[model samples]
Target: MEILDLGLDILTWAAILIGCFFVIITGYGLLRFPDLYSRIHAGGMADTLASFLILGGLALQSGLTLVTVKLIFIIAFLFITSPTATYALAQATFVAGLKPRVDEGQLDDTPPTDKVEGGKD
Candidate 1:
């Protein structure tokens, strides 16, 4: 095998390893994170990145096979659906009037009902 082929193999393995790492980190984040929003963020970030990495590595390994086409399809589905799921979750939180963390950056414009009415029910 050529040096270039060896390099590609190394990269493919690296991508797969990193994909596993993302999955593990997300699992840990789900257990360790303080709040729902933060946990959601971690889950989304890890899932998206891991999908990218795994699909990329699979594509590399698949070369010109039908597996590559299937991997591409999987990646496309993931890319389309993950963001939509995350957006729906965030919208649900917002519409449900979930409060953002105080340390969370750049909050929305909607004022809380308690703040406006001066004494929550």
Candidate 2:
């Protein structure tokens, strides 16, 4: 039982440390990314991953308990909503005429066939 406790502690801490590292990287990307799209991508992906890691770590520490169950629910909610929210935000920005920054060879020169006009489909 003592060994098992120690092992759980180590695993929990490892997950927490990794999650913290991702959170730091996300902050850096949000600050330094060249474009809104890149920033959004970093923020969304990192936020979801970090939340999962951190909450999973906490769940592990809590063992089989109500707190762990609640954390799992929160993780699931974030997993579902983060990407959807990011897509919605990006879509809204595009519809509002905020064009993404394009780089050379990133896309073809051809214009989009379905153009959004006045935020309409």
Candidate 3:
């Protein structure tokens, strides 16, 4: 029983540490990304994954208890809502005429840099 408890503790801590690492990366992305769209994408992805992992670790620590059950519900809510919220935000931005930056070889109404640069062929 002691060995099992020790193993659970280690696993819980490992999950938490990994979740923290992801959260740090997410913060860096939110600061360093070039545009709103990219920043949103980075933040949404990392936040969901990190939250899930962190909650999972907490649930493990809580074991078979009401706290664990609540954690599971929270995780489910997050998983369901995060993506929907991101999509809505993106749609709102689009409706507001916020154009996303596109790379070369992509189809967009925005004129290419080469064309704008004196029509160089």
Candidate with best lDDT: 2
For 10-107, candidate 1 gives per-residue lDDT tens digits of 99999999999998998988777666677788889665889899889989977899999988888888889988999988877766666666664664
Ranking by lDDT: 2, 3, 1
lDDT of 2: 0.83
Off by over 4 Å in 2: 104-121
Candidate 3 lowest-lDDT run of ten: 112-121
* Candidates' C-alpha lDDT: 0.79, 0.83, 0.82
Which pairs clash (backbone N, Cα, C closer than 3 Å) in model 3?
none
lDDT at 87, model 3: 90
lDDT of 2 by residue, 61-112 (tens): 9889899889989988888888788889898978778687677756344444
- TM-score of candidate 2 versus the correct structure, residues matched by position: 0.83
Clashes of each: 0, 0, 0
Residue-level lDDT tens digits of model 3 in 33-58: 66678789788956488998899999
Is 2 or 3 the stronger prediction by lDDT?
2
- TM-scores for every candidate against the unseen true structure: 0.76, 0.83, 0.83
